[model samples]
Target: MGAEGKTPRMTSHDAAGRSDDSDHRGYLDGQLLIAMPVMGDPRFERSVIYLCAHSSEGAMGIIVNRPAGSIDFPELLVQLDIIQKADQIKLPENAESMKVLKGGPVETGRGFVLHSSDFFIQDATLKIDEGICLTATVDILKAIAKGAGPKHAILALGYAGWAPGQLETEIQDNGWLHCDADPDLIFGGDVEEKYLRALRKIGIDPGMLSNEAGHA
Candidate 1:
């Protein structure tokens, strides 16, 4: 929502939009939701959303391309009042420590770790798929404090969420086009390219897309 109007409160439907007939159950599990050119919502224009979990209950994902600024892991630690030696460079497992990412516009103050399955939160972990997971507990942080965290990770500070049927409606309206989810899309590679790249997974050049998704 940044620079745009306040993040619209997600109701049972998306942006209070009219209902559409597009089926969304096919969007379950690992998928990528790419914002079409006609998506008027400033928050999503050119945005690529990595769908972690989608179902009748609701939908959840992360915005991979948004950067969290120059702040890194050690800087975040200092902000959190966790003192570490100035010489103690690098993350717990030799990973980049200051790689915090802006996950979404909502809950800008919260944090979510979208990471590979090599690490678990011991108890507080959301398994998004076979190879990806999300952790929000401090236990994972502790592991990272000593450089013992997962092999691959991107610490995001929020998440993209949707109400049941809301996302389905959007898909129907051509607001979003989806494809099979990829781990690298969520936690690896260029964040900004994820959305466009996702569209390519299905061989759909986003540039050639028509706002009106006409189903025959």
Candidate 2:
């Protein structure tokens, strides 16, 4: 899960033959994806995903709303040898309350850190947007354990991945609705309310949504 290699650069072309940032080319990068009511996959039902990267190559995101049951951050630190059992009670306030989420179905054993831009590690962090960044190395975890990490963050086990054009096709098929992302929406403690909150952010009432896909 170490992100030590060179990060892939993704660019997009505009109509006038000009190149632009992939996120600005109508892609869902750095946005929140709200699973449609008719979602067929049980793994993603009512999921609220924060897209970290989206380009012609593929798309990658973390499910921010699904808690990784039975996983506790302090215990995880002890397991990883970042701290000892006796140190659990001494964890900082943010570390004590930090969430552990099931990012997605892929690479479930690995860890990904979706955090605020206040902290960074050279070559290990991918700045997703103005306020968010993704780091898949254990270094950030050590920082968090030491109370030297970002202002806000969540540790996700695994991530959602799509092949080239696969996500675009899903979007065209009405599998998702995307909207701008905010720190509160991404890092809030209300896990069960994220899906509904994301829908409301897109100006849709959850109670009014139907299972007809496009009718939402």
Candidate 3:
């Protein structure tokens, strides 16, 4: 799930329009989705996703805690033409330190940037909440290349998608648990800790979480 082109940005209306309808049913926009041990989909096993948009129509999220193994940030910058291999050394600390993640099982060829609300691009950035924004445009990449981007960001290749009623059904089947998003858990450098930490956020101890689904 790797591609280099114009990043696809979500519009405010597209991401925010369904909130009121979803709030009534407990929509999970801007929350963390922690895959349960019983998650049948191996692709999502032990994954932690940041729900970017959720509605009765469907849901979309980026895997916040899964790293795209062997994919380094600077190397990706060069591959995407956002920077030259020779110029990688000149990147600022935050830019150089950005993490590349395997966002999910969908659109594995595209890229999405989940970032702090401090940076924005008119009509290109979707403000998901008070502290988070989603920008898929290349300008954010360029800004990060120059160390001028958001203070914290995660560059995810691909995303997780669900059909209408899919996510809710999974939850009912004991396939996932969700909690309020924490900046550290979303943008932090520690990929391995996110899953367990997310479970803990909901007052669940990972060890105690059963891996079996039940109907009773």
Candidate 4:
């Protein structure tokens, strides 16, 4: 909510975020997972995920394109007591306009912040890549509320998760496609355009892609 307003408190339906880092990194850390049109689950249809950690234990990521429609960043800060409702006018531009996304299908009650590497908190931030980082602690939220946080960030409630080998099997089944992460794609303001844009990033025409999963 940077220069826009305070972050809004998430309602029951808005919950869906939380994450932990994995160093064992089997594969997919710092990658983008684009949902296939044939994706069986409606919840993840056309979703774009920022894979933070993946290994034999499982995988965890935040859905970058799914916004918590009813939640606002600045309003959230006020609800969490990080800032007074009257002090909202004092927030920096980036802080007020920062977006809040619906991260994934799990834990839909907590919060996670995925941001640029320019900011970090000791033992709190999980560096996902050279350009991206993730922080779930309230301290970062406090910093953002005070206008002293990362240069770019998206707050998400909940996260998507997969059990051991679950993601791999899904990919084999064509449930998702993989690609390198790009800042514009990850932190872009256009939520509705992300799905189509991501497909184009990998040189695929979304309009031509079929819903039936295939193996080549």
After superposing candidate 4 on the true structure, give the runs of residues whose Cα lies further than 4 Å from its correct spot: 1-26
Q: lDDT by residue for model 4 over 17-76, one digit each (tens)?
A: 434444554598899999997779987999999998887778889999987877788788
lDDT of 2 by residue, 1-216 (tens): 322221212112111222346366768889998899777888899999999878887888999999888787887788777899999999999999999888888777777889999998775778888999888777888899899999999988878999999988888888888889978989999998988888887788888888886662
lDDT of 1: 0.65
- State every prediction's TM-score relative to the real structure: 0.78, 0.88, 0.88, 0.88
Off by over 4 Å in 3: 1-25, 214-216
Query: Candidate 1 — which residues are off by over 4 angstroms?
Result: 1-27, 83-94, 210-216
Q: Which ten residues in a row have the lowest lDDT in candidate 4?
A: 1-10
Score candidate 4 by lDDT: 0.82
Tell me the deviation in Å of residue 164 in model 1. 2.0
Q: Write the per-residue lDDT of candidate 1 for residues 1-216, one digit (tens) a residue.
A: 331211112112111122322565565656677777667788667777777667777877777777776546665654554446573564454444435676777676666676778887544666666887777765565566767777777766667889998898887777877776776777665766766677787788776777565532
lDDT of 3 by residue, 1-216 (tens): 443442433223222223345244588988888888788898899999889888988999999888787777788778777788999999999887899888887877677889999998876788888999988777788888987899999988889999999999999888887888899999988899988888888887777767677422
TM-score of 1: 0.78
If candidate 1 were superposed on the true structure by all CA atoms, what would the RMSD be?
7.4
Question: How much lDDT does each candidate structure score?
Answer: 0.65, 0.81, 0.82, 0.82
